[model samples]
Target: MKVCELERSLFESFPKVDAESWDHVGLSVGDPDSTVGRVLVALDATADMVRRAHDGGANVLLAHHPVYIAAPDAFVPRSGSHPQAAAAVFEAARLGVS
Candidate 1:
């Protein structure tokens, strides 16, 4: 399934509007046009989790909590801030996971 299609499906069941105003829900990383054959769901998208998802052959990752949370710089590993989360984000992007 395509990433956009998967987003739509997830919203149908758990609408983004349903999420708390402070919550960031939906695809965190990856291209919308990308295709996914398998998905990995987790509460947090930690560096370890990202590696596991890639190693396990999961093309998409459905996370309950937002990794950025209004902090865009947190996803940059080279920034030396939020390294673990950044590692996860970078790894996920490298693996083409959403």
Candidate 2:
């Protein structure tokens, strides 16, 4: 299946998540939206990733790195604990993370 270019763009917009300085957001497989039939969201979408998407009938995986570097203290609306905390407040309105 053909993954959408738009979905790849979403990955590009993300800030460097890894703080170890030795790893990258590795994707050894296909593109982001490879004809996705479902989606999963998690701190590091693993089995939990598939579970979320699988149960929801989605094939997409949306994961946030646990060690993913974030600038919660920065001016940018960072995808850090602050945003995560805020999201926990309202499951209906999830904001964008960069």
Best by TM-score: 1
The 10 consecutive residues of candidate 2 with the worst lDDT sum are 89-98
> How do the residues 1-98 of candidate 2 rate in per-residue lDDT, one tens digit apiece?
43455355655776446335754353322344456554456666333344445557654555565323342242222244455323321221121111
lDDT of each: 0.79, 0.42
Per-residue lDDT tens digits for candidate 1, residues 1-98, read 79999899989988888888988677778899988878888988876787788889988888877766674555654355565667778888877777
Error of 2 at 36 (Å): 3.3
TM, every model = 0.85, 0.42
